[model samples]
Target: MINIVYRLKSPKFFEESIDEVELDGVIVRPTHLSICQADQRYYQGSRPANILDEKLPMALIHEAIGEVVFDSEGNFKSGDMVVMIPNTPFGEDVYSPNYSYSSKFRGSGFDGFTSDLVNLPEDRVVKIPDDFNLNVSAFIELISVAYQGISKFTQMAITPKDNLGVWGDGNLGFITALLLKELFPKSKVLVFGKHQENLNLFSFADEIYRIHDVDDDVVVDHAFECVGSSASQSAIDQIIDIINPQGTINLFGVSEYPVPINTRMVLEKGLTIQGNSRSDRVDFVGVVETLKQNPQLFEHLEKLITNICEINSLGDLKDAFDKDYISKFGKTILKWNI
Candidate 1:
């Protein structure tokens, strides 16, 4: 199969006749690839490592939902819908000494899901429930990050508390709020964003307020910053301003550079800061359980997916990155069905 390959040192290359899996022991055959912020950085040369190098082209997609066409280990059978959880095993790579989040990301430094087929390993694939929506399930990896962040929030209290304040109104922000709503039905949630157009996209929150318009009386027990930029610092500051004393703040966004934060207030409020990364297979399983137990939580997921395109060759692939087209899509997936 011909696959879209990201060569770190050179331009993006599509290679044909290569084996389905890399020699490093990672199984993958690219299927659908989303141009995430990480992909964008790689394309622009902002990120290090030569993608053209054999190691870098290993593939690029981390957030993917697919079907298990084959599994030699008998862990899964053909026709099972699954979500790929990319994580490098211990000792697999010299850098995986601690098995941190960076060790297992496919698209981060290896081959990704932007190809016609991704031959993922059994352990990397999480079987989705028969009734789970594929499109919504694509957000499972992301939901894991949200889940981890919120899970931290639940841990801070001797008793589980639910009130949450979500900062930023991007897809991550919206999805995090959705998971919070489903996971903690009794919790009162508030959403803060600068753009009404973006804020209006989500309906999960009990109340949505502009950053400057946030009410002073509402004290949240948990807060999150979903936007991955320096701008998020302001959002964090806002979150700290309104959260109750000892509230936990979850920073789930991917920031390419460092941003200034107000440590004094964080200390004064006895705040707990938490950061999360792509989830594990266990996280996917938990999310599937949530979806199975509460089917109604998916009611608005379809609204979150804005576009899907089929890519046959390199030409169509370029169109996939055309900022004009992708900007309008909340989740733009390059489908390799053709």
Candidate 2:
């Protein structure tokens, strides 16, 4: 399997060129293939300094649900559908104390899931239930993220009656809203996005609007930031304006640069703030179990995936990533025919 590799800040389809060498005590297969956001970014020249130093070029596809075609150990068998989790941990680097879910992340300094036939560590993959659809099952990572946000606020001193608002109606926001509604059945969950078209995508929002509609006098109990941009900082200002005293604001979205936050308002309101990553193992398993027992509960998510890209080769992969036409819809996928 000729797979994409990142080296020296460049991404290329390297064919069986480096398989003869050993990497960090692990032998790699030359026939590997996979595709995901990580791969696209690397392919498009987005290289972090740390990754460049480590020579961290590997298969990239973190959000993947596929069948295991090879099993060196008895722990997995061919044809078993599984979700691949990245082995990269937050603690691997000296600067990871503040990161969330330090345990397992699929992509970023780790080999990803997009590959035609890539070798996987035995412990890095988890078997999906027989009834789960691999395409939909691939969304587990995203669902786990939403689960984490919901879990954090619920752990705080608030109940189902607390007022809740999510800023941004993107995939994360919608998922968080749905999760919040489940966790806090009675809380008012509103979604604010830049556009009304996005609001239509969220079936869980109690109310949706543009930023201009923000009522300066209204008090919100729970607020979430989902857009990972400096604009998210403005969300902090809005949170301070709308939240009641002692309310909580969850900063889920992150920006590349440090966005200015209103520290004084936070101090004055006595707001509880938190940053949540992926869900805990218990919560992850529980979400799977709940979906298994009540499959219909997540029927809405099926529609959320509005785009699917069947990746056959690097050309196909590049087209999907570069051409706006392919990504205009919601979630996109690269189906590997093994």
Candidate 3:
């Protein structure tokens, strides 16, 4: 079969190549691919030059859902919809998924799932419910990251807190806060964001506060920082200021530069700071089960998808990435019918 792949040969340029694909393994056609900040950084040439020089000329998408076309092993039947897990671990490790030193994450260290058909090992693909929306499944990889972070948080948290806080109203913040609320329904979830319009979309949050408007009296037992990039430090500062003593701060964001944290305050408060990245199979299974059990949660997650651009050609792929780059809030999904 002819497989056409969209590769980033240079900044702002995607070249396509036609090649034959081996259908011996599980062959899945990517139906929906979501653009992540890391993908954008590669496309826009914002990443460090040395890293870009090494990783460019590669496919640029990791978050995606696909339909099975062929599975030689018969583990998954044709026409089954599945979410792709991008992290491919080479060796076993007792540590978490992202922490595994031998892991190869797609769209970063390896080519990702943005292609005509993805041939993955049976273990890297998890089948989703037939009734589930493919658009929402496109983001399951991201949602699983939050699931993994929260899972770690639950394991490490010393006590149950009635209140939680999420910083940054971006997609990660939105999903993290929503998942927290769903998992802990009775807890009061407070969201802090700079943009009121973006904060408005977070209706699930018990209270939304503009970063500057957050009162001094507001206290949270735990906090999550979702604002990555240059704003990560500021968000961490705010998280430290309001989080109660001995609170756990989950760092879910990615920053290109070293973010200086207040070590003095962290030590004084006896806080626990944990950082999370890509997720594993356990997280993927948990997220899929949660979506199947709670239809309403799936609907709420669908609201986070702001743009769905269809990719029919190389031009369409460029447009999808470009549109996602300009989008202020929500996720941009590439409908890969090509």
lDDT of 2 by residue, 1-338 (tens): 34434222345443222332222211222222224344555666556656654544554556666666656556666677766554444455543322545554545655555444446565445666888755667677677677766666667845334678888776777777777776677778888888677788776667776887866555667788887668888777787788777777888885657888788988997878887755434455656775786676567677666656565655666555564234543566556542
**Which is superior by TM-score, 2 or 3?**
3
Give the C-alpha lDDT of model 1.
Answer: 0.67
Report how far off residue 30 is in candidate 2 (Å).
16
Each prediction's RMSD to truth: 3.7, 4.6, 1.3
lDDT of 1 at 198: 80
RMSD of 1: 3.7
At residue 81, candidate 3 shows an lDDT of 92
Q: How many clashes in each structure?
A: 27, 11, 0
Error of 3 at 5 (Å): 2.0
The lDDT of each candidate is 0.67, 0.62, 0.90
**Tens digit per residue, CA lDDT, model 3, 155-264:** 89996679999999998899999999999988999999999999998988899999999887999999988999889999999989888999999998888789999999
**Candidate 1 per-residue lDDT over residues 1-338, each given as its tens digit:** 34434333334444443444443323434455455666655554455554334444444456777766556666666677777775545335444211353364676645566554576655677767878766667667766767766665676654336677788787788878888878778988788888898888777689898888866687788787887777887887788788888877788877767978889999998888877666666666777787888888777766766667677766665566554244743776666554
Per-model TM against the reference: 0.85, 0.80, 0.97
Regions more than 4 Å wrong, model 1: 1-17, 20-33, 48-58, 92-102, 158-162, 323-329
Ranking by lDDT: 3, 1, 2
Candidate 2 has its poorest 10 consecutive residues by lDDT at: 22-31
Instruction: Give lDDT for model 2.
Output: 0.62
Off by over 4 Å in 3: none
